[model samples]
Target chain A: MPVLRGFLWLLGFLLLGETLVTLTGLPVSAGVVGLLLLTTWLRLHGGGLGDIAAAAQPLIAVLALLIMPGVVGAFFILDALEGQWTAILAALIGGTLLSVMTTLALMRRLMGEASAPGEEAPP
Target chain B: MTALLDHLLATPLLAIALTLAAHAAGTRLLKALGAPAWCPPILAAALLLAGVLALLSIDYADYRRGAAWLMLLLGPATVALGLPLHQQMPRIIALWRPLLACLPVAVLLAAAYAVGIAWWLGAPPEILAALAPKSVTAPIALGINAQIGGPVSLMMGGLLITGVATVGFVSLGARLLGIHDERIIGLALGLNGHALGTVRAFEIGPVAGAFASLGMSLTGILSALFLPLAWRLVGA
Candidate 1:
């Protein structure tokens, strides 16, 4: 039953994702939309999703590994990137620093407010 | 024998095997080094694999032929993020007002800061455009770059770097500030780090992971909607 339930959930997720992708024409990917749909249904229904989520977690956990091959392709393009190295470096270093600063500032503000009187910090 | 060896090497299965091996070795290395949980195995694997490919002078297309299955999984994995968001809906609902306010601000700040700094550093126009969407996840970031005529390779590099830096630094930043709340930490990581940050959050705890996933998904949407307009306003 657990196995069957898992399969069904996977099927549902894929189907919904495909349907939404076909419909929306938005930039968001279909699989992402499918995941959102499943999540919403699981949240509202609260059935056997915990088990399903548990099963899916490990696969999703190592997702970065899945992109590694694609990233390795970077080596092949080194010469092309070489000519533009300065610009690439600027974008990476500059973009990263800005993201870090922005993240820190927002977190500080949110934490400050949420910690205000009587509202216990969320565990 | 050489033809058979080449065929076996060219298969996607080989790429998957290599990736798994690299990831396992990288994680073990990090553990041995007592690196924090936020040290991403993926980032390590990418670096190591790039070195291997370059040293051998293998064509990327051959590597990609083997590794493209990884791309297929990206969609499904992105969808699965919904489960965590669903679990955390109550907390998300409670913080809706602040979250709503924070979403656009966070999105704009990330996009602007990346572009502004890139420009200030004298990056070329194409590089600046590519950096504009670096905070979002790969699929969306790639799409946006393509649409805007940015360099796809540069954007991919930016995405990987952004992910690693966010994962690497968020925990250290939180520890430095003496702020240990998992939810806040996760939110910050997700908003800036995207998927890589969310993975880091999961190591902290389920609650942190949940919030991180929520923040990641929302940030992707928010950035997609507002980033272009923000870019226009900045005249970039």
Candidate 2:
């Protein structure tokens, strides 16, 4: 029952997200808009909604699994990748490296040195 | 016998069962191997399924018919991120300044670097477009791709590669760069790697996981809203 209620909340948000997009014609993801809305709602509610957690945990656990089928579809279109292989490889390797480094540098600069992992966060 | 086989193949049940079975086997194999970070169970399952389908000559479309049901759950799973985001709100609220300051720059740069690199490599416009949203989660990336006229396959390909590569970069690169703070590491992971990075962040710690989700959700929402508009403005 808790799980069902959780799904209801999720689907309800998702529907609202879709409607929002349709009405506003925003080029955004309905699921993501739903996520933002739910976060706001949860914040406003000011208490843990255990039912959503109950449903959300299991799904979160297997997130990679849920994404696999779509990832695997890339295999079928291997031919489309025939000529662009080197470009794809370079972009992934270089772009990821640059992006990671950029974020790290900016974060370290802006946020300053963070305490080590096990320490309690600073107030 | 032929009719029975045809009927079985025609239904989504077989495909769904195969996906579950393959995922189960992959998880077992991963556990048996001590669960390496570089090789996520989902990658294992994907490879296993790919091998099986190739050997059996089953069409991908047929397989997706059933697997699409599994994909539907992603919408809710993504929304479920709100729970953790809410749980971590206090910390997030505390760090809101750095986070807000960092998000737009990081998000746009992540997209820019990817598209820039691909373009410099002489990738065509469509490939560049596809690469623009690769750092965000797949659904949003795919949605942005659809709007901007990139091939779905290439976008998916870029997304999978970016996800895996970001994990390698973050796990190893953070340590190399002397980053001991899991918050920064987690934020970087989620920012550059999206959901895959978020998963890796969870392995680091709960705090890292929470931050990763925050980064990932914000990145997705930001990229989805802006990238398509940016693509048009760039006129590429």
The prediction achieving the highest DockQ against the true structure is 2
Score every model by TM-score. 0.87, 0.93
DockQ of each: 0.48, 0.64
**Interface RMSD of every candidate?**
3.3, 2.2
Model 1 ranges with Cα > 4 A deviation:
A1-4, A46-51, A74-77, A113-123, B1-4, B55-57, B231-236
Taking the tens digit of each residue's C-alpha lDDT, what string does model 2 give over A1-123?
898888888888888888997899776778888888889999899444887888887878877778878767766777878599888789877899899998988887787765655476532
lDDT of 2 at B121: 84
Model 2 TM-score (2 dp): 0.93
Candidate of highest TM-score: 2
What value does DockQ give for candidate 2?
0.64
Best by lDDT: 2
What is candidate 2's CA lDDT for residue B40? 73
RMSD of 1: 3.3
- Give Cα distance to truth, residue A61, candidate 1, Å: 2.9
Lowest lDDT 10-residue stretch of candidate 1 chain B? B140-149
